[model samples]
Target chain A: MATLIRYALLLATTAVLQRLLLDQIRIADVAADGFLVLSVATGVVAGSRRGAVVGFAAGLALDLMVLTPFGLGALSSLVAGAVAGSLERLIVHSARTLTLAVGFASAFVGVLFFVLVGSLLGGVGLVDGHLPVILLLVPATTAVLVLPVRRLIRWAEAPSRALSPALR
Target chain B: MILLLLTAVTLLTLSGRGFGPLDSVRSAVGSVLAPVGDAASWATRPFSNAWDSAFSHDDLVAANQRLQEENDRLQGQVTQSAIATEQLQELLALVSIPFVGDTPVAHTRVVAGTAGNFGDTVELDKGSDAGIEVGMPVITGRGLIGRVRLVSASRSTVELVTGGGFKVGFLVIGTSAVGVAQGDGDPSRLRGANIDIAQPVTEGQIVVTAGLRGSSFPPNIPIGSIASVRSDDAARQSTVDIDLYASTRDLTYADVVLWKAAN
Candidate 1:
């Protein structure tokens, strides 16, 4: 129950931040993907089921906002979160490199999955020509931010874990 | 069981089947979440305001001076106001569509945004209780921003034109070059496709919303201007770059175009 509450709070907080703050802060019209970073981080720290659950919730929250056919984001995030969670199993140490690598890969897959599903919906076109560039940049960008994000996630989750016996 | 139930709910909604419970669930969730969103927005409002203040200092000063000069010039034109008012009255009389409608403009504040790298949406502080609904077109003095994608009782989400899935039919002012403008997931970048090669397209051409057949958008609303145009023989279709007139960076408020087409 405590784990569930933590997941819910984390998901809600990230959704609120993405909606309220991050979207306004653009550098040359590019805003950081705070939710994606958090999703990956949550997956790495909390394990696969929790990660996938949070990712799905977050993505569904996004689907409610955009015009795209619903389920595209939810599915993509679910898959990305699961992959990140499994990756955590392989790495013995949750070092900066491991976290970054997982984050970079997950972000790339998440974006790609969304684009592919969206294009198939026939509602609008993807930035098909820039796919390669986005693919390259998203992972690299996520990787660069992973260290700091990992630290923040650790700090936030530690107290919650201590408070909740289920976290053990 | 929870995953299965969630998936079932999601699938049902996605398939266009009416999930009666979904609306209630969404409303309950929205009301509970609205305050948190509002508080977050309030916290960040100062930072954005500070950024805008610092960035627009010089420009604001120059603009103030220019406005002062323009005011002086416009003072002379005020003498002909009687004649202009008569002309305006005549034009108003000529318009066939009823200007008066049920839709009332309600101001809303930004509450939140869509999550992840697909950053193309913002949440508003207003919701169904405020008479907002999905498909309501959102705008500002500059031009169109987007439409309300979803609404709860106390909060709503707006999909901006900078999102990947947004598309608007547009026309290049001087030429009959019609194309579809799509968001490049970046506000500074927009793409217009389906232009005919023979059409005389040029840089800096004005683009306006080419209202679709029986669509809600009023025709000729300024959409953007062509930043660049490209033609390739291989593709047989030209692409034009558009620079949006409205800056999402400085967005504060938007008007919900409440004119729903009469059935």
Candidate 2:
């Protein structure tokens, strides 16, 4: 129950931040996507299944907030989360740098997936010569944000484990 | 993962097909979040403005100079226009005349500047409740900005003319030439085509809506002024670039013209 509430709060807060504040601030017409960064950070801390679930939920919330089609964000985020989680085992040896690496990589994957899928679905302006700018900005912004966001996700997950080890 | 993928696909397909419930869901979500967004914007606007001003002092100075010159020029034109208006009014007293200014409009505030990552659109505070409907043209004091793309009970989205895929018929003032202007995925200018190469279109010439039969926009809605013109020898057509009179970056308010194009 505690984990669920934390996840709900995370989703809501990220949605609000993405929609109201971050979207208003643009660097060369491309705003950093905080929601995408948070989801990728979630995958960095959690395993594959949990990561995919969180990503799906995050995508749905984003879809609801934006004017884009219903499932574009969802599909892109799910793929990104799952891919990031699957790479967790390999990066466990380099655990010290895990969050940063996964954050950048997963954000790259997520944005690429978004552009490919969005263009296929007839979305305009996704490839209007800003693709390279978006690709670099989204991931670099995610990389800068990964450490704190990862800690937040871990903090949200930590209480549940302490409350019931057997439940895990 | 497969189930989630299937669900996402189902949603994409359904929404693309214009499923009614999906629209309702979007509206419900907007209604719930609009106030929260407004509050956040109000709280953060000062910081954003300060950040912009800090980085853009030189640019702002240059822009101020440009505007001062333009203002001086326009003031001269306005005086001439006033004289012409008086003359035309006396002549029009002989017959009844309907003017574009007589069209009903709903003045609305822009609640949010840009909504999503994919396209350039702004959110307005008024929607169907204020007679704003999809396809209605929106304009500011400077010129036309865009058209209403989506509307809910109390809010609506206006797709800016700079958004890729926005196309509108336009005519060059003082010429018989007409063409279609379209956003080229750039926020600063629009690309125009289908113009006859022989047409004497010059830089800084005004462009206004053609408002042909079955057009979505009403006639004489100012879009922009020609920035450049290039002749396409093979096609015998001229490619014109238009610099918009309205800047989307700092839009705070606009009027939604309630007039719809006649079929």
lDDT winner among the candidates?
2
Tell me the TM-score of candidate 2's A chain. 0.88
| Candidate 2 lDDT for residue B23 | 72
What fraction of the reference interface contacts is present in each model, in order? 0.22, 0.61
Interface Cα RMSD, each model: 4.6, 1.7
lDDT of 2: 0.83
- Backbone clashes (count) for model 2: 0
lDDT of 1 at B71: 89
For B1-263, candidate 1 gives per-residue lDDT tens digits of 25733783465355345444544455566677677667767787798678769999898889999999988988887878758756655664696422222246668876566534454677777878888877677777566778776678777778788777677888788788888888876666689999888787999989977665666555556677889989976877789999988776556777776655434
- Give the TM-score of each candidate: 0.69, 0.86
The deviation in Å at residue B107 for candidate 2 is 2.1
Candidate 2, residues A23-121, lDDT tens digits: the string is 877787778887777678778788777778888888888888776778888888888788777777567375646667777888899989988887788
In model 1, where do residues sit more than 4 Å from their true spots? A17-21, A24-28, A32-34, A46-50, A61-68, A92-94, A123-168, B1-31, B49-92, B95-104, B107-116, B123-125, B154-156, B161-164, B167-213, B218-249
Q: Report the number of the highest-DockQ candidate.
A: 2
Q: What are the per-residue Cα lDDT tens digits for candidate 2 across B82-186?
A: 898677666545655334455799999998877646778888999899988788999997788899977888998888999876889998988988999988677
